[model samples]
Target chain A: MTAHPDQTKAGAGRIVISVDAMGGDHGAATVVAGIAHSAKKNPDIGFILHGRRDELERLVAKRRHLADCTEIRDAPDVVSMDDKPSHVMRHGKGTSMWSALESVRNGEATVCVSCGNTGALMMMSVLRLRRLPGIYRPAIAVMWPSRNPQGFNVLLDGGADIRADAKDLMQYALMGTSYARNGFGVARPRIGLLNVGTEEHKGRAELREAHDLIAANAQTSDFEFVGFVEGRDLPGDTCDVIVTDGFTGNVALKTGEGTATMIAERLRDAFAYSPLSRLASVLAYTSLQRLKKRIDPRRVNGGVFLGLNGTVVKSHGAADPTGVSAAVKLAFQLAQSGFSQKLAARVASAALPPQDASSDDDGGTS
Target chain B: MTAHPDQTKAGAGRIVISVDAMGGDHGAATVVAGIAHSAKKNPDIGFILHGRRDELERLVAKRRHLADCTEIRDAPDVVSMDDKPSHVMRHGKGTSMWSALESVRNGEATVCVSCGNTGALMMMSVLRLRRLPGIYRPAIAVMWPSRNPQGFNVLLDGGADIRADAKDLMQYALMGTSYARNGFGVARPRIGLLNVGTEEHKGRAELREAHDLIAANAQTSDFEFVGFVEGRDLPGDTCDVIVTDGFTGNVALKTGEGTATMIAERLRDAFAYSPLSRLASVLAYTSLQRLKKRIDPRRVNGGVFLGLNGTVVKSHGAADPTGVSAAVKLAFQLAQSGFSQKLAARVASAALPPQDASSDDDGGTS
Candidate 1:
């Protein structure tokens, strides 16, 4: 892949990543391990593991192979997942999550990755790194587990903001499309607004307006607009990108995660029951092994917080070493593709024409 | 179990079930097979399968052993899952789904079960069966797939109503509790409100108010009032009953279903990959069978629509014979339990105090 002329002039084979070593269930050990794994494979990548020096030192000591690849930046405090976003923003200075985000703000790092409190990460990113000019809100983008070999569907605003208007939804579409092109390498991503139905008048009034905005946009029109998709279509690869409010998106993401865990648990329970069935399971062992590899959560780890000024990927809190490694890989690819810059540019260019915008102005209508 | 006073007066073992024979993915065949399966085990249960004459006749011929236990009632159309709820309500008079619901209203059956359009089922039941006096809206109750041997948690309003106030949420708690005690035979079911957090002010304003209502109520407070639960807790047996709005509940349910299907597909893919992993699967065969049985959707098919005037159960649209059979059994248990009457009494008695009436009067003060 060729680097953009503008980016090529800025740097050569240089990509800095800031990882929140204090974040996630597995803590700094997994993050350090992941960093070591990625560094060995990609020598061009450099990393700053932000956390308490003593804790990170202990973990790094256990993994001597990662010694030369990583540098530790001291962050005294660690943010808990249960803490409120507002509280975190006000009081979380010097914490690993905040400090890591700050690394990106100062250009010390090109990207930030964490498996900590998502709300806190977003809050700190917005407060410190700030939003890209002309962008209203940052959207949390997630890949919906799909049936296709090409992998999953990308959903935006998975849980960033509570309520969004038509313009915000349109912005999500543009940002998501850009990310799909850069990150997933989809030439022309099919975007779908999540709604109760496909009819123009189906959902709440905001949806109807958003539908019109998407349909009328010349910039977005270049990509496939598949109208609307239902909740069931999420895992079926019906569209490359799905967009919705944070409330719905959060619930959908949690529901998907919970369901996956439940099924795995259930499958385990089913195979443990009887001797004959156990024998049958043995006969079908090859098929079962194939199934486990396909559905493993470790294969899909990091979810990008799209529409931000810089790259910020959120790994699952429960992610293990394998999952953490995948997250590092994902972050590296996203950084290399310059996904953040591309998304910002696409959304800015997609702004409605001033004259056409005034024709249906509702600035004071609500 | 002893028969209720009213049921005894009517006749012991005379509960009639109206089944939507032409509904579901397998059409009349699975319905007939389910009826036959239930009839062989339950002498007290009787069926009235509603569908076109010829199709019903052919199905009945295949289940001739159940000749004494089952009978058919003619109906013309079948409501498709994709049909709008309002459209079906306006034009579903002669349809199998509508006719089955009507049988319960006409006293030809004590309970109704259909594997058709869920929205239409709720609409027709509300329109024909009507709500119990003073009950605002009917709730669709479900047995959550719990981790314990205590069976499942009861979740109410599983996509029946879009918006629910604090009062409606309280009623959902009451109805869900009653269903758990009477239907599932749990002495004191633990009730929980689904929320993002356990704190009092965590969720939307309505949920905060609802939490107070549940805690303050004398009747509802008698049941175990575990504060709040997240999506992950649903399958972990954290609470016996969970309450939420229809939109969130519906999305969660569909998301869970989709995830399960995706995992199954993924597991198949995993097993087909290589030899060593296949050998590992063979060694773990017994555990796999146990897992499958525990998570089998067929074993947990019947989902009850609570807060209605009478017993109404919904079978999965894609359910086969085993799933439909489980639904039939659930319908019978619900009818025998007199859960609706108990819920009505509890809710009515809980509202007798005038102090409860003044709580909402100060709404504008906030």
Candidate 2:
């Protein structure tokens, strides 16, 4: 696959985002609406929607103004969220996700966005675009909801590698730091290893080894190593970046997300319980909106799979048009900012010598 | 290190819970108050409080009614929560926590409960009590908050084994199941492995293997296997028992506790901001109390560390008198039920022929 820098014939700025239209619960309607909304706001952006021709046409026909900014490519197969990663890759020949990812690989689009099976999207992206040299496993980096919107924590391998060694953890730190710096414009991002305690030699064997490797690495010295952080610290803006194996990270991320949603649902149910409560809810509309904005997943929809050669953003499966639009904007920001290129350089520089590597390998025994 | 069934004279048919009175933030005062409160309600319960001579006498003098049910044992040192686990064990001979556990080990008390440094407690307990004949690593089993009052989920290895393989997971399942059946009085507990998905091959290699082993083993087969469960299912009473390694389990448990507290704090702050809101809160005091009862951590304070030869419960460090009282009651219930003995018999009988013969081998890798 070659990187081709192409200019759109429609006279929009040369960047194009290939979206898996058939992905997520809402399917093509959400992607089409989100694209139309984003294109109207940012006239420089264009989209290539990949899905079944009939459904794509029907969704597009509902929005006449989007005809100029949007185009559809036929990709009949759809990958469900429950599908196995290998199954998706093996059977998803002309699937929307496959085509969307291929568009990024072929440089027809600057970035690819999907709200499909996260594992499948990750596998397909790494398989299609290939990993950057020395990057054994690509990581999925997410911005967790924090008390300070200006400072969000980055967590990688959200569901990628089951068991990661110290070397993988170091790579995650490097990639996550580079992402925070380039994508979010944070300077000298403070990196932390997620553990039960902050003390040295506190966590599992791999974390202990990773701690030593991170402390000794000269290249990572440019970024701040803030030692260990607990689960409570993730929401407090204690560190700009926190790294862990995919299993723990995924559980923590999902737990946070589910808890937020559960609380919101409970509040809604509480308000609907009585007429007096409903009136009080109306009276407290402003305060409620402030709370909503604080916990809104839409405000943090895009989760970038860092360490991959090409840019791939995974949005929430249940995201509406607004969330999808935000995801697209975030993807564009990451791609245009050259986040991947910067991360590649940082990881290359941080690579440890083979002799020193022996001390860090814990046999991936998580 | 012989197991002494009678180290102290039986003072009535009551169960004595040895408490490290100097363990938590509130010190001997809270422990004395909790013991007094529990003793007032349950005349059959007694407490052996361990702490410094001066502080113990000072606190005990204030509560005259406690003299009938409580006895103070002086210990020279106090183990700070921040102290390293290994260092604390090496130098904790006369510490309050050490003395408390010693009381249980010598059969002076039926159970030992602490709200102190968890790592130090685990180290001391394992060193003093020793593991069960076949048990490799002891696991901490906690009751996860569920929708049904009678239905509570068990999470094992809550912060014990940082690195666990298939065998560890299997042991956690077996031990947790036994706890649910004995502690919760469930006829046959339904066990669910905490994983990202319900598919057979969803989790890491260890989980996959553990799932197969549990399905094949007759001891585990008696209990209903509900398959995989996510973090969201924890509060919904989807399973009778939930199992995972310590690292993930600890994070999930703490995250739930912290998030719930954070939300409650936010609500209180919101209500306290205005006189009118404060008045409204006052008017809704009864309803608020009901809500508090629904989510009270005090209702579930004691977390039993299963896979041991005897019952040992770890209480929350921040627990109040009410929480401490609940922990003491729970410890008494576990001992009276004879859960650990029955569990040992079941585990021994269900093991493979070779496993039964070689059960004494200590260093075998799981």
- Each model's lDDT comes to 0.74, 0.74
Per-candidate TM-scores read 0.86, 0.86
Fraction of the real A/B interface contacts present in each candidate?
0.41, 0.21
Give the true-structure RMSD of model 2: 4.8
TM-score, structure 1 vs. true:
0.86
**Candidate 2 lDDT, A151-236, residue by residue in tens:** 35778877776668997888788788778887787878888888977767677888999997776763444788888888766666
Which candidate achieves the best lDDT against the true structure?
A: 2
For model 2, the docking class works out as acceptable
List RMSD in Å for every model shown: 5.1, 4.8
